[model samples]
Target: MTDHAREQATILETHGLTKDFKGFTAIKDINLSVQTGSIHALIGPNGAGKTTFFNLLTKFLKPTSGQIIYDGRDITHARPAGIAQRGLIRSFQISAVFPHLSARENVRIALQRKLKVSYHFWRPLRILDQLNEQAQATLEQVGLGKFGDVKAVELPYGQKRALEIATTIALEPRLMLLDEPTQGMSAEDVSTVTDLIKRVIEGRTIVMVEHNLNVVATLADQITVLNRGEILAEGNYDEVSNNPEVMEAYMGTTDAA
Candidate 1:
C-alpha cells in the first residue's frame, strides 16, 4: 500500500477533539490516528478520560468541539447506530451479553441484530439455524468454540470477555474500539485475551484502552497516553513507554494512588 493508502486505511482519526461535561473537560485537543489493520493502544491512569474519548467516537456522547473522522467520513454528529452502520463498533469493559442466555444464543442475538432481522414475539431463534452456525464460527474464532453451549453466566470470567469480543467481531466492523479489554483476569487469562485480541485485528483496525503496560507493549503498533483529559505523549511503545513525561506521570500517580 502506498503511504497515503496506508494512512487512509486509518479507519479512525480525531483532530483537535475536545469534550466537556459542564465546565469540566473530559478530553482536550486530542489528535489521534489509527492505521488500518493495526493495534493502537490508549493507556493512562484511572479517571483519565479514556472512556470519555471512546464515548465521543462511538457517539455515546457528543464532542464539545473538534471532529471525528472514520473511514474517511466525518462522524462528529453521527448517532451511535449510524456510526455502527458505517462499520465502526465498540465493546465495553463490562460484558454486553445476556447473562441467562447460552453463549451461542448471545452471539445469535447479536448476529440477528446486525442483520436487522425482525424480532417476532413467537418465532423461535432456531428458525435462524444459519445464524447459529455463523455465531459458532465467531465463537471458534475467539477461542470459545467449546463454550457455545454453556450459559454465559456460568463460564469463567475470561471466557465471557472472549464472548464479548466474538459478538463485536460478528458485527464485521472495519474499526473496533475496545475499552479495558483485559480487566479482572488472571495472568494466564490476560495472556490468552491478549493473543485473542492480536488474532482479531488481523484484517481490521483496532483501537483500545488498555491498562496493562505489558499488553500495550506486546500488541500496540502505536500508543497514546492520556492524563486528566489531555494527551501526554504519542508514539510507538518504545518511544512513549520510555518518555520522561510518561515516567513522571506514572510515578506521580503511583505516589498518590
Candidate 2:
C-alpha cells in the first residue's frame, strides 16, 4: 500500500455506541470509524444528537452500550484525561483556555499539561521561560504570534478560538475533535480559521462537528450526516450532498445557514 493509504487506516472506531437519559436515547447504535490523516465531519440539524455523539467520543458521557477503540486499544473505559494523554485531544470549545492569562501563558499551561510539569509546582522560573518560548512557537503556528503577549480575554472573538486551537496543538494530538470550530465568526474570520484548520490537519486525523456546509465542503475528506440519533448518510461532500435522503434530511431544518 502507498504511504498515504497506510495513513488512512482506521485510527478511531466505535461499535454499537449508544447513550440514553431517562430512557430517552440521545445517540443509538452508532458504528463509526475515522481514518488516520483524514478530516471527517459529523453534521446534522439541531437536536440530531450531534453534540451527544461528540460527547460520547470524548468520554464526556459514557456509552450505555458499545465499545470505542483508538489506535488498536480499547478506550471506551478511559477517562477524559487518559484519552487525551493517548493523543486524542478535543477543542473548539469555550472552556479550553483561561481568559485571565495571555495567549503565551495559556499555551504554556498546555505545554505544562503535556509535560506533566504541573505536578512539580516548585519547578524553577527559568523552566517556564523555556515553555514560553515553545508556547510562542505554537502560537505562531496557529497565526497568533502577534497576540502572544495579549491577555486572552482582550483578544478579538476569532483570535480567541485560534488561541484555543494553539493550545490543543500543544498536546500533539493524533486525533483532534473540534466542536464547531467556526461557530460564530465574521466571513473574514471564517476564512482565517479555515486556513488555520487546513494548516493543522497535516499528518493528523480530525473529527469535527460543524454546521457550515461551505466549510464542510471545503474541509471534509468524508462527511457523515446524523439524524434522529442515527447515521443518515456517509460519503464525500458531492456524493452525500446529491443523495436524495441527505437532501431531504436537511429540508425545513436550518441547513440554509
Candidate 3:
C-alpha cells in the first residue's frame, strides 16, 4: 500500500476524547487513530478504561468531550444502531449469544438483522435457505462449521467464542471492535482465535482490548498502551514493546518479557 493509503487509511479517529461518570473520569483527553485493514491492539491493566473506550467508539457511551470520526464522517453523537448501519460493529466482552439457539440459528439471526429483514413468527425458518447458507459460510470462516447444528450453550467455551466471532463477521462490518476476544481460552484455543482474528482483518479494521501480551505481540500491527485512561505509547509491536514506559506500566519493570 502507498504511504497515503497507510496514513489516510485511518478508519477510526478520536481527538481530545474524554468521558466522565459522576465527577469521576473514566477516560481522559485521549487521542487515537486506527489505520484501515490493520489489527490495532489496546492493552492496559485492569480498570484502565479499555472497555469504556470501546463503548465510546461503538456509540454505546457518549464522550463527555471531543469527537469520533469514522471513514471521514463525524459520528461523535451517532446512535449505536446508526453506527452499526454505517459499518462499525462491536462484539461484547461477555458471550452475547442465545444459549438456547443453535449456532447456525445465532448467525442467521445476525444476518437477518444485517439485511434488515423483519422477523416473522408465522413463516418457517426453512424458508430462508439463502440466509442459512450465508450463516453456514460465516461459521466455516470462523472454523465452527461442524458445530452449526449444536445449541450455542452446549458447545465448549472455545467453540462458543468462535461462534461469537462468526456472528460478528456475518454483519460484514468495515470496522470491528472486539473486547477480550480470547478471554478464558486455552493456549491452543488462543492460537485458533488469533488465526481467525487475522483472517477477519483481511479487508477491515479491527480494534481490540486484550490483556494477553503474547496475543498482542502476535496479532497487533500497531499497539497502544493505555494507563489510567490515557495513552502511554502507540506504535508497531517492536516500538511499543520496547518502550520503557509501557514496560513499567504493564509489568512494573523495564525488563523485556
Candidate 4:
C-alpha cells in the first residue's frame, strides 16, 4: 500500500456514539476514527466521558445510539468476550494480574486464550507447558524476564504494571485500548512504562485515555480532547494543545490578550 493508502486505513470507528444513564447523557454524538498503527489519545479533564467511550467500544456498555465498527464490522451489540476474541483488548488504570500467580503463569493464562483453552484449567498441566516458552519470551519483551518466577503480588508496583503489559501482549491484540496506563506511578516508573508503550506500538494501533500530557505529546499521533461528554478539540498535540478552548478546559483559562 502507498503511504496515503496506509494512512487512510482505519482500524476502528464510532459514529454518533452516545451513552445515557437514566436522564443523563454520558457521551453525546461522538464520532471518531483511529488509523491503523497509530497511537490515538483521548484526553480530557475529570468526567469527560473517556472511560464511558471505552466501555462502549469494548462492549462493556452498550451505546444508546450509533454504531461501533471495527475492521469494517459493526460490533455495537457484541459481547465483551466476543470483542476480545476479535483482537480488541483493554487494560485498566489499576494493575490487573493474578496476585497469587507467578509472572510466567499470568502470561501463560493470557496465551492460553490463543490456544482456545482459556477456561480449561481442568486440563492437564502438561498441556499448558507448551505456552511456557512463549510466555517467557513475552515477559522478556516487557522487561520482566528476570522476575518470571516471582509472584505478581511480590513484585514492585512498577513491575506489577509491567506484568500487566506483558499479559496484554501475550494475547496478541490487533488493537489495544489502554485506560490510564500510567495512572499512579513515580516519575521513574512512568517514564519506564512510557518507553515500554513506545516499544510495543509497532504493528498495532493503540487508543489511550491519558492524563499525562507529556506522554500524550510524546506518543500520540492524534488527539481528541473531550469536555462535558463532547469533543472539544481534535488534532495533533501541537494543534489541540494550542487551542484556546482546550487550554481553558485544561487550565481553566487561556493566556490574557
Candidate 5:
C-alpha cells in the first residue's frame, strides 16, 4: 500500500522496530501495521521480545532503532504521556487501581486524569458530580454498573480486572494496548473479561499481548506470531496457527500460553 492509503487505514505501525540492550538485540527489524479498527494479537514464546516491544510501543522504553507511527504521525520518540494524549493508551498485566477507592471513585480519578485536572477533589462540587456521572457511564459500559459503591480492594479478582478496564475506557482512547488483561483468573473470570473485551472493542482499535490463545482466537482480527524477537508469521488465527514454523516454535517452548 502507498504511504497515504497505508496511513489512512492504519492506526498504529512500526517500521524496522529494533531494540538492543548491551549488544543483545531484543527485537530486530519488526514491521507491523494494525488496521484502524481491529483487534490485533501479539503472541510468541517466552523471551520473544513481546514485552520489550510492548514497552517500546507504549514509550516505556525507547527503541534503539525504529520508527513508530500512530494515526499517520511519527511517535517513536514521543514520551508515554504524550502518546497517551494522542489516544494510544496501554495497560499493564497488573491493574492500576487504587485499592482503597471505590469502583466509582477509581473511574472518577481516571476521568480526572484524562482531563488533566488536579487531583484535589475539593476543586468544585458541581464538576465532581459531572465527573461522577461520566464515571458511572464508563463503569456501566464495562459491566460494573452494580459495583460502583464497592471498594476496589474488596472486589473479586475478576471484578478488579473489570474495574481496571472501566478506568481504561474512561480515557476515551482511540487505540488501546492491553498486556495480559486476563492473566490470572478463574475460568469464570476469563469468560467475563473475554466478553467485556469483546464489548469494549467496538469502533476502536486494540492491540494486546496475550497468553490465552482461546481469547485471541475468539477476538483477534489479526495475529502476529513472534519467535526470538522476530515475527515468524502473521494473519488470522487459523493461518498463523497452521504454520509449521509456528508450531515448531511452540513445540520447543512448553509455554503454549
Candidate 6:
C-alpha cells in the first residue's frame, strides 16, 4: 500500500506519549501507530512500559503529555468508559472474569453492554434472558459451548482465560488490546489460545503484549520492541528479531523468547 493508504488504514496512533511519576518515567516520547486490521505485538523485557502504554491507550492513565488519535478522532482526554463505549476495548493482563458468575453469565454481562442494559435492574429477567442465546453462541465461539453453566472459578486455568476472551468478544470491539493473552499458560494451552485468537479476529484489530516469540511469530503482523521505556525497534518479527540492539536488549541474545 502507498503511504497515504497506510495512513488511512491506521486505526490508532500516539504522538510523543509519555508518563511520569514523582521519580520515574514509565514511558517516554513514544509515537506508535496500529493498522486497522493487523495483529501488532509489543515485545521486550519486563518493565518495558508495555502495560503503561496499554493503560494510556485505554485512558486508564492520562499521558503526562501527548495526543492519542483513534479512528480519526482525538481521544487523548477521553475517559476509560467513554473510550470503551467508542469501541476501544481492552483485556487485563490477568484473566478478569467474575469468579462467582457462570461462564454464560460473565459473557451475558458483556453482551448487555451492547444492548445498553447493563444497569437495567427494573427490566424483567426475561429482558436479560434475551442475551442467553447470544452468550451461549459466544461461548461456543471460544470452544466453551458445553461449559456455559460452569462457574468461572471452577474452570481450569486455560479455560478461564478462554472465558475472558469470550467475554471480550461479546462486546464486538473495533480494537482489542490484549495484555499477555497467553501468559502463565501451559504449552498445550498456549497453542489453544493462539488458535482461539486467530479464529476470533475477523473484523477487528488486535494489539497484544506477548513474551512468547513463537506466538508473536505466528500471530503478529508487526512488532515493536521497547527498552527502558523507549522504542528500540519496529518491524515484522524477523526484522526485530535480527536487530543487534533488540537482541542486546533481551540480555544480549535473541533467545530471550
Cα miss at 254, model 5 (Å)? 13
Error of 5 at 74 (Å): 0.6
- Score candidate 3 by TM-score against the native: 0.93
Provide the lowest-lDDT 10-residue window in model 4: 1-10
- The digit string of per-residue lDDT tens for model 4 on 1-257 reads 89657536999999999999998999999999899999999999999999999999998898999999998789999999998988999998898899999999999999987788878768888888999999999999999989999999999898888899899988889999999988888999999999999999889899999999999999999999999999999999999999999999888899822
lDDT of 1 by residue, 1-257 (tens): 89887767777889999998889988999998888888999998788889999999999898999999888889999889898888898999998889999999888887876555746747765676779889999999999999899999998999999999998988888889999999888999999999999898878888999999899999999999999989999999989877877877888633322
Could you tell me every candidate's TM-score relative to the true structure?
0.93, 0.93, 0.93, 0.96, 0.94, 0.95
Candidate 5, 1-257: lDDT as tens digits: 89788668989889999999999999999999999889999999889899999999998899999899999889998989898888888888998899999999999877887455656656764565668888988989988999999999999999999999888888889999999989998999999999999999888899999998898999999999989999999999999887888988988643443
- Expressed as tens digits, the lDDT of each residue in 98-217 for candidate 2 is 999999999998898756677798888567777888998999999999998899999988999999999999989999999999888898888898999999999889999999999999
Relative to the unseen true structure, what is the C-alpha lDDT of residue 175 in candidate 2, on a scale of 0 to 100?
Answer: 97
> Which scores better on lDDT, 3 or 5?
5
Model 2, which residues run further than 4 Å from truth?
A: 1-8, 253-257
> Per-model C-alpha lDDT, please?
0.88, 0.89, 0.88, 0.92, 0.90, 0.93
- Candidate 4: which pairs clash? none
What ranges in model 3 sit over 4 Å off? 1-8, 119-124, 255-257
Candidate 6 lDDT by residue in tens digits, 1-257 = 99888778999999999999887999999999999989999999988999999999998898999899999889999999988988899988788999999999999999987677788889876777889999999999999999999999999989999999999988889999999999999999999999999999899999999999999999999999988889999999889988888988887766664
Give the runs in model 4 whose Cα sits over 4 Å from its true position: 1-8
Q: List the residue pairs that clash in candidate 2.
A: none
For 1-257, candidate 3 gives per-residue lDDT tens digits of: 88677557788889999999999999999989888888999998888889999989988899999999998889999998898988898988788999999999999988887444646766766666679888988999989888889999999888888899888888889998999999988999898888889888888889989988899999998888888999999998899888899888878999847
Worst 10 residues of 5 by lDDT: 113-122
Instruction: Return the lDDT, model 1, position 174.
Output: 87
Model 6's TM-score against the true structure: 0.95
Model 6, residue 225: C-alpha shift (Å)? 0.5
Please say which candidate is ahead in TM-score: 1 or 6: 6
Supply the global lDDT for candidate 4: 0.92
